[model samples]
Target: MDEVSKNNVIDFDKEINLLRSRECFNETGFLLLRGIITQEKIKKLRSRLEIIFDGSSRLSASIFDFVAEDNFLSLVSNEKINRVLKQLLGKSLRIYPNLTARKATFSPWHVDDAFSGNKVVNNESNSQFIQVSMFLQDNHYKYGGGIDVIPKSHLEETWQIQEQSLSESLEIFRRVRNKSVNIDSVAGDVVIWDGRLLHRSSPKLTEGGVDKYSLMWTVSSIQSNHKEFLTHLENRGKLKESIENRLYDARYQELTHIKRSDFSNFFLEKIKKLDINLTLKDSS
Candidate 1:
């Protein structure tokens, strides 16, 4: 590796060791680090992201739709971010093509693995998934829609609290709220957490509305059975065949019946407006 790559690897190792020892995430279900990315890089990324969001109508509709945009995936393909992810997750990581949400969007409190029949156990080995959110703008508690995490919630074995009704969930949030840390991040600050942790986006309370731009990515260990997991995404009409073919090779054949025609015109139009070239090079 070159100097920059070498330095990043070293730094990543340090962060990984720190992450393992601190228990900060277990205690809070989140951790924050400042200056993770240079100011210049954040400016460039924000510029590109803003153009995409400006043209894409989906961003205003719902957080799920906004996150499924192709341009958002293109943005997260950044090498610097991927390097850190590789160190934390391993080289066989597969990134989900989702960006979490922008302003006015809120993710309900739940665990990603809940649908898979896995409960949040005390051992990390039972945690099958991880999520990382890279903030491209400054987020504050007053801004609302900021992420609220239940510290050490991932260690709980049951979904007793998470299964409650919305009102009940909010009441639980109010009671066990150890620390409601607003992820006030300037561009490039990344927050990594266990997927089983109980997390919800606090409502956006900004005046006249404010756009909270963020890049969210998930990573799973190699043994996490991504093929089966990806099949689930594909069946849900979330994965494109073109990328799926490349990622899964012959495995795509098994899922041929699940493929759907690409209908993400809005997502593609935003990419064109941003002027970011996205032609995939031939692997052969």
Candidate 2:
């Protein structure tokens, strides 16, 4: 083939892969990028995370935006993560304040969009909001623990999706569980999911083993969906007065979804626009 033709094929292939990744996420509302970070990076972050936990009782299994140190913040700027995010959230991806670190925590089946079943039906422009989670262990039967998701279940919305009983949610899950996926990821793997997707913590199949450690953050391109989800989060946060008016609040609070996405963006955005300290700490 001619030099020009060869170059064209290579460029075309690259463009196609980019489009395919975003297309898949639009349909499924989640993307699992295998080994997106190095194991060494995961180890360092895990060590620091362990220190942050300071050997607290395993009973809690979570820390709310505990630390925004540089190492934890750098994961978001990882090249592979940026690439996928650019495809999904456009070039203007703005991260919401707060980073959450967790160890072996579990949450029941739920949606982050105010528990609304159909508010996020349109995954086009509204797909700007996404959660990026990095797991520090292999998700296998023996190792156990990962996230389970309902495929395409994010494409619906109601002002509020009534909470379902465990048995009831399970019954519904059982009916369409075949269409869902339990992300079987490994250490250093990254899972980026839409805010509206129905998901829950995958259980540890074995009785004993080191627990899983994960770091998560939320980012979004300006879109209408952000407004809806934020309103839902703020109201829930106010229910328990979990909303922290401070830029870098450190209290443990459960305000629906990941507490990182808990505050109203109006609140976060106001702080962000001021070029306050909420932006990622420069790793440079």
Candidate 3:
């Protein structure tokens, strides 16, 4: 695709509005919210990040939720995303704890079957989840990097080539690359794609290049199967924490602070109003 159609990308506050932005996500499997976050908030986050990080990339991103920092939470819960999410998902939204912060990193081609027990995730026909990512700096082909995705790829059955042979994966990639396109965005933009969509970081990984700071998190519609969803979490936790050979540990261990007891009255009440499920103990 040369450029995403107007229907797939919308201004954060443009008055000439569509009746519902949710339709875009359903049809295209992704939506770009232009300038969803202001520069002020992005600047604040960068400053705080400078203090907390030592110029190294890490996968344990649960620190973003620390009540002490409160920097990332402010962005995650902003009204722009909440409104879009509420409209796409129902009034209630359940955000998974699988958030990640990456710096100048590139990922291989794959689909996100996050929290699912096994790799045979073939249920994208009615997907109710999305991966939300926002970059701290501009993402482009010239100066920096961004995501490239196969639009509507969710409609096709996926083959987790990482589990299969390289020859088979190469054959599949030859075809998959025919449909992929680079997605460019600025610091304040938010990019959301369906959980089943085939996507990857663009321009490949380099030795030394512009830093691509991105924060990614997942969200689910409350109407999804809760029991199965909980099981997915259980499997994800055990598989990673137990699996010796792993690139990054599962996020469950880093989410202990989400227990209702850990949240103060102020944030607890706020979280309650957002209908964010504090699933640590199922109480709160």
Whose lDDT is greatest here?
Answer: 3
Please report, in order, the local distance difference test score of every candidate based on alpha carbons.
Answer: 0.49, 0.59, 0.64
lDDT of 3 by residue, 143-205 (tens): 455687778776665545443345664666688877876776778788888777877666544
lDDT of 2 by residue, 147-229 (tens): 77775766753323334567866766676666666777678778778877777777666677666788777776644355555
Regions of candidate 1 where Cα sits further than 4 Å from its true position: 1-28, 55-57, 60-91, 99-103, 113-116, 119-126, 160-165, 178-180, 235-284
Any idea what lDDT model 1 has? 0.49
lDDT of 1 by residue, 1-284 (tens): 00111111123324444444234444444455444566777676566556656765443323334434554544455454545444445555544433344434455666554322443223445444568776665655566534666656667534454334678766755766664444444456666666766666655665644466666656655556555555454443333344443222222233333211231555445444533222211101
- Candidate 3 residues lying further than 4 Å off, grouped into runs, are 16-20, 55-57, 64-67, 115-125, 142-144, 161-171, 204-209, 244-246, 250-252, 256-258, 263-266, 281-284
lDDT value for model 3: 0.64
Which stretch of 10 consecutive residues in model 3 shows the poorest summed lDDT? 113-122
Q: Give the better candidate number (1 or 2) by TM-score.
A: 2
In angstroms, how far off is 159's CA in candidate 2? 10
Give the poorly placed runs of model 2, Cα more than 4 Å off.
1-16, 58-67, 115-126, 156-164, 225-228, 241-284
True lDDT of residue 25, candidate 1: 41
